[model samples]
Target chain A: MTSPTVFAAVGEVGKDFFKERTTDTLPCQSTDKLFCWDWARENFDRYETPLRQHVELVLISVAIGFAIAFALALLSHRHRWLRPPFLLGTGVLYTIPSIAFFFLLLPLTGRGRDTAIIALSAYTLQIIYRNTIIGLDNVSKSAVEAARGIGMTDRQILWKVEIPLARPEIFAGLQIATVSTVAIATLATFARGGGLGEPIFGGELGIDFKTNIIIAGGLAVLLAAAFGLLLLWLQRLVTPWRRVETE
Target chain B: MSGLLSQLPFASIDGAIEFIFEPQYSNVTGGNKVGGIDKVVELTINQLQVTVISLAIALAVALPFALYLGHKHKFETLAIAFGNAGRGIPELALIAFMAAAIGVGLLNVAIALAVLGIPPILTNTFVGIHQVDRAAVDAARGMGMTEFEILRKVEIPLAIPTLMGGIRGATIAIVATATIAPLAGYETLGDFIINENVYGENGVLAGAILVALLALALELALAGIQRLLTSPGLKPRPA
Candidate 1:
């Protein structure tokens, strides 16, 4: 009842915007209840770890996906016949459901970030690989001839001429990979790698936690949109010639 | 032989086949209660129901709307926005989100799958109809055909292959997604893996392979349909 006790109570009350997750003890295991925040509270800045980890997972997956896809596409481009089978193999990989894909990798890698990355990269491979192949094929033949006439070696022609011309398509593929990976990495929760979906499947909060679900789901959508816009900006930066061609 | 195969660290090819074929006769019921061939067939059918019903719903709604949009030459910006937004949400995320709103059940899972199916079909159909030769449409118009008739007679035929591209894409994607239907309280091939207590390690491995095989089979079937649907003259020359 003294001044010191009053001050401590006020500070604790104000600390978490709402009470910490343990505030509510819902005994109702019944699914009939409306989605209520009685059991849930979002401390606004509590999402920092999930946000950082989600972004990291997405960037790493897309980076690895683009590199692997580029190599495969390049190999196929050189051999010509390898393109069909390469496309077929990756297409089959894409057709595997993301959850099932995770389980398939679970035994090999066990759990956590690496397993999530491998599965997500598998999903990204087909899109980037196909786009890379298209980008290379679309490089103007005359441009390749022009590069050769300038005494460029085969590797130099690819590095200097074809890849530069193909930048937009390759970047476009990266954009797709980035956005989708951000979205998919949310489910990295299932792989024991926590992300936005931690609250989404409701976990400790239970499925009926309204505020938590909104915060998590809304963040996931926002993450995807922000990442997508960043890619679009990067694409514009990397492909200034595209603007010239279009306008 | 099956016992030996199961003891292997990971699932072997022989294990998957034997699990599928032998479980019906043998005493090898997984903890998931997936007894044998009858159960496998049942789960397969359940998976198909989710896939087929959801796909049908998505196609029914998206196709007509896309064709109409193409006919009117409207909603191009909206279509592009929808496509981008749709691609940004993973199938698992969509399914879980729907489960929250509707509660978990077979119908809820099917609705989730349907939402997954819509964007590709809508995007592809819109692009397809838009890509039809303008001169042909102008000629058909000049011949006094109504807008609807022009769309049907001129645009729809030419646009079939591209429209089917959307269908093929959606079908394959939905079939894959349907594998998770069991996790949301609907029984499907995923039960083999999702109910870890029931199927244990062998179920998980065999289920993964079965789902993959089912998807590949669907892809092959859809590709064949895509070929059949493509106009013979539109088929590219052998390279």
Candidate 2:
């Protein structure tokens, strides 16, 4: 059969399947009622609660991960023996499959948000740690020497000089980690507290195509715009000097 | 350091090896023992296959687009915006959408991964090519090279390190993300981990170690590739 004919046949098959499955005990009335914007408006709290929790999970994990990564980066910079293994290990952690990581944690921690947080936090380590190291590495040797010559203590040099200079790279890492954290949190839906993944999975289980498409597509657009704006704001905050330098 | 290391919980390499290779420890779904070495090996290979295929697709699509966007000022802003959007959307959501639209299986997973993998590659490609020394490009053009020739012979070689860096990042991301493939019912190492969790077994720790090992192996391999690609004569030195 031609492609259009094939699609039509598939659509009919899907319709028939839905019809067969439809029963008096079906949850949430008919699928048609669920599609209405008014229905979503009325049940906004149900959706919003999960969305907020997912966001909270992502933010907290990222905050904690960034703190750990920053400390590791500092320690790695000072101790030559620690650098290689630390970099290599974090790189590996960053690369491990999120699902595998979550599952691995799940046995110990069980299902739900905590496991998801730990998994996502582990994933963020490489980006934040590597970027922190790279940012410090990229700091001009002369700057460090100058600080030392001026009698700045090691801690003072790091907090006052190196970190300020490394802010841009750190922000870049934050941008990456934040975006990644948001994306991965959608998988938290698997543990049952529904996020954007709910509709997509619902669609897979033969729920309404339009509903799933709307939820997934709308969420994608919202996330992309929001994060992009966030990066812009962060850039402005961290590197106000950028504007002056360019000007 | 020795005291600290000893104090912390440490699983020996030998223990890991034994757990991975002994048949008695192998627990497949349906309460069957599939044997350890074979199960772990199969799962590793499965993940490797998915990562490589997805990375290949990402590189192929991202490179040319990056080149095109780099050269054309009119399209630059739009290209960057597109990449930013791609970077923002979570891979899990993208995978779910793809699975919903195309139905589940390997191809859907690959396509979803490729989508997730594209932005980094594209952004890096554009940045790499744009950062190619102007003098080199001018000299190439002065030598009567066509636009295509300059890009192929002059710009790309210089940009390879940055491009490779992006590919390295993309490869790592895809390999890590591909672990989620089991969620959609495709059998991968993630299946072993997820299933072990469902059954309340010791396999979870084994699965974690396996994933860690695989990720370490992938990072080493990619670093090796990056080193080879960025050798002295092949690309410009890092500025």
Candidate 3:
């Protein structure tokens, strides 16, 4: 409508592209260097709370997910008709994206760690449940038959024979769930849950700061790897027969 | 709990539904009408565009390589490792890093999304083809089929379910990541979710609903395609 209006429109459009996030007082940050070691050294302490939050989010989510999924798997294994419905329910939960899931629960759960953990745990349900069921199904029929011949009860057979044999697949599911939770928990920031995503999404220096992105992103990757390795080690410890078989 | 729920912001299910169907006046937009079916449809199309392009690129790149590896029975560890590593790369970080470093647009966002798609496809394809019955391949070979023909007519057919599983996983990941494409300046369905200042809370809820539906629909469509492509004989018969 006017010259001032046109200029203002142009400035609004170009601001994200043209504006410098940092002042020239800091040479590395102002120059838009790929990674500023000096800036990182100074600002690295800010990532501590976010990193801790990220770890807690992943751990709590995966733990709750594994519990629910494992219980469901056992229940469905006994009641054959429940299997399909359980699978469908968890599949729907899994289908919803983490970001959307966060918001969909916003009204009910409110924005916080509780909302994030619920969504993240829900996402894990399908994967872990499916794997656990598959693991149970894949147990050798002969072992069950032998246990029956020995006059073992159905519960006893399931606990002793089927579950023991299903260890590898069950542990595999746990590993996958843990790793995925580690990655997705970074989005917990959207729910005001606070995680590594806070730093990447411009906690202090803003998203334009490559150094911040590198530190936050790298920590997430490292966290995933750490959880993955920890799960693998735990798996080996719990499944002594697996070690023997591999050896 | 009900009392707590009533006190929360943006908890209006009815309001979100109305926001999806009709533009509403927004104080954030200075009383300008924002969101509605038209804006939702436009953004949904943009989201689907990025998702489809990224998936196509991922399939084109990962399929051949995975198939070759499966056929040769080589580099099993490498294929499997990629699957593990890929799962660990946080989607939020990947997109933010891409936007910050490589600059953002449809292409950049698509590429970032594709990076998420490739590993699942590669791992599933390799495992699927590798696990195909050796007898089936030998029979195809005995019928004077070339290696390529055997792969096309026998191996791929047998591996359809597993291959489709991978594609479904990739589709889910790509579609989910595409919801964040607005951060990269691509104006996907995430625009409503991200620019809450203009679109308001109702639009945010609507965006979430639409994204969830879109993902489920894509998954269902892929599952249908997988079933259609599979040979009739391979279909499980009821006792």
Among these predictions, the greatest DockQ belongs to 3
Task: Extract clashing residue pairs from model 3.
Answer: none
- Model 1 agreement with the true structure over B55-133: per-residue lDDT tens digits: 9899888989999897777889798678677777655556655554455676667778888789889988998998899
Kindly indicate the candidate among 2 and 3 with the higher TM-score: 3
Displacement of residue A238 (Cα, Å) in model 1 is: 1.2
Q: How well is each residue in A93-117 modelled by candidate 1, as lDDT tens digits?
A: 8887766677676446656788888
When sorted by TM-score, best at the front, the candidate numbers are 3, 1, 2
lDDT of 2 at B227: 76
User: Residues B140-236, candidate 2, lDDT per residue (tens digit)?
Assistant: 9999999999988888888888887788778767877777677655667666555653422445556666776677688788778887766478755
The candidate, 1 or 2, that scores higher on TM-score is 1
TM-score of chain A of each: 0.81, 0.79, 0.86
List TM-score per model, in order. Answer: 0.84, 0.77, 0.92
Q: Pick the candidate with the highest lDDT.
A: 3
Better of 1 and 3 by lDDT: 3
Instruction: Tell me the lDDT of candidate 2.
Output: 0.69
